[model samples]
Target: MTPERFAECLASLRWTAIDLTSALQCQLSWIEAMEGGQAEIPEDLARWLESLAKCHEAAGIPSHYRGVAQF
Candidate 1:
């Protein structure tokens, strides 16, 4: 995903770079770089985001509510 979209996904999940990094066991700089467009988003990170979205859905969080603008 594009950096902007990744950032939006994080916002939708109520997460920051710090949160993602901690959850994914990656460096904060890596998450920041990806979100800032300084580096390409890793495949693992993309998959993690997708999985997290699915989990949220399974938890009954509506898509509309999880959108960036909703919070």
Candidate 2:
């Protein structure tokens, strides 16, 4: 996902970059860089985000981000 998409996703989840990084047990800078597109989305990070979204959905949470179309 694009940085904007990722940022929107975080907002939808009521999570900050620090929260996401803490939740995923990653570095704050790493998460920021990834969302900023200073670094590419690694396979592990991608999978983690996918899993995070799924977990949120399973918990009956709705996505705040509409999609790439609106973006």
* Index of the highest-TM-score prediction: 1
Q: What is the lDDT of candidate 1?
A: 0.81
Question: How do the residues 1-71 of candidate 2 rate in per-residue lDDT, one tens digit apiece?
Answer: 77776776676567899998888898899888978899887777666676776677668745675474752
Q: Extract clashing residue pairs from model 1.
A: none
Which sections of candidate 2 miss by over 4 Å? 47-71
For model 1, give the 10-residue run with minimal summed lDDT: 62-71
Cand. 2 TM to true fold: 0.60
Misplaced by over 4 Å in model 1 are: 54-71
Clashing residue pairs in candidate 2 (N, C-alpha, C atoms within 3 angstroms): none
Model 1 per-residue lDDT tens digits across residues 1-71: 89987977787688988988888898898888998899998788788787876676568655675547743
- Model 1 Cα shift for residue 45 (angstroms): 1.9
